[model samples]
Target: MKHPTSYRTSIIGRTAGRLGVLTAACLTALAVAAPAEASTFSYPGHGVAVVHDRATTHADRAHPDQYRDSFAIHELGAVFGLGADNRATAVSAGCSASHPCRSIALSFQIVTMAGSHVRINATNLGRAVNEQCPGCQTLAGAYQFIVSTPAPFSLDAQARNQLAVIHHRLDALQTSNASIDDIKQRADALAAQVKTILDRAAAAAPKDREVNPLGTTGPSVTMHRHFDGPS
Candidate 1:
């Protein structure tokens, strides 16, 4: 019994009314779940070590020094993980009494422990049988290290909202003529609330990284935030 055009208009109005309700719901949800400002973490620098080998003479081979050169990566508190890369280059050639001076073949091992120090060991072939040429058969190598860091600190909508409420309360207190003691007590309570909020955020943040080479836990990265109550 309805006109075709009027029926279409009625249907259109109902559809638009439903769409408007859905849009309002979405906007309210977005506002309530608004995200906090963006944040990022700080990354530590990489570790490195370089070595220059000393020439081993045939006679000196009789009493070879067992100890190798090593270096440590300090300030590891922020480092979470590490990767090591090493390479060696032949520096010189040495001649023995029986053979002509030739480049000596060298092999090395880069050892990293759970801690920061890295040990570099160059293989000692054998005692030289004849008088050896000086400064021959030496190599130079370097160890480059890569480090991983933690994620940055950030707050979610809930934390931001909690902070905002605390801010408003503090602002009201600041403008009030309440007793100094009462103000101090309220301020202290607010500061405690702030600490609790920050502590929860930190607990949920990224933890320390485990470095493969270190074979143990790396240094801990922590954010130190202070909340001072009203004096």
Candidate 2:
């Protein structure tokens, strides 16, 4: 793998020239298997592989001057997936209605998606995170990073089959002609087994999250990550 690139915060959403991370065949397989997830995080770059895009409005009672006004607009990416890229990126937007947005400092992490069950390259996901969004940026101290929210991407074929098998077992248990107590016993056993399986899957599954514990302290703020499409 190449040495990780340095990322700086920019109010204007832009991308430097990118190097290809995978061959055509590998990239094709990844495109088909990994679908866009719906969740996101802020202050990324820890263990997670993807950061879904999100936005939030924060008010700073102490330093309103740092922001255009008191409140600032923060745009963060969704958490990372296992088979995705290691370095995640997000932007920070200022509060001013008239001012343009900008990216944040320490905006990315350096990771290599190796040592996992799946091996999906992260080129496409990385590009999407850095280049796709427009007017993406926020003011200083608008976003917070407390912990990583694990957002798993679509399971590969084998993982899906494993899940399907568990579902089938649950269905069979529901239809079995047994006393409630007996069914409960059997179901309990099944649940234990399922937990074991899920644990393994979770270990192998492509997971993502952000890393920002002890974020800027203020009243708890609600952040919204928007990737739904044009208004």
**lDDT leader:** 1
Query: What TM-score does prediction 1 earn?
Result: 0.29
Candidate 1 lDDT, tens digit per residue, 30-124? 33332221111112232222122121212123222111211112212222222222222222223444433222111111111222332222222
Give one digit per residue, the lDDT tens place, for model 2 in 102-168: 3221111112122212223333111112233334432211111112123323334674465456445
RMSD of 2: 21.9
Name the weakest run of 10 consecutive residues (lDDT summed) in model 2.
64-73
For each candidate in the order shown, give its overall lDDT on alpha carbons. Answer: 0.29, 0.28
| Stretches of model 2 off by over 4 angstroms after superposition | 1-151, 206-231
Give stretches of model 1 more than 4 Å off.
1-150, 208-231
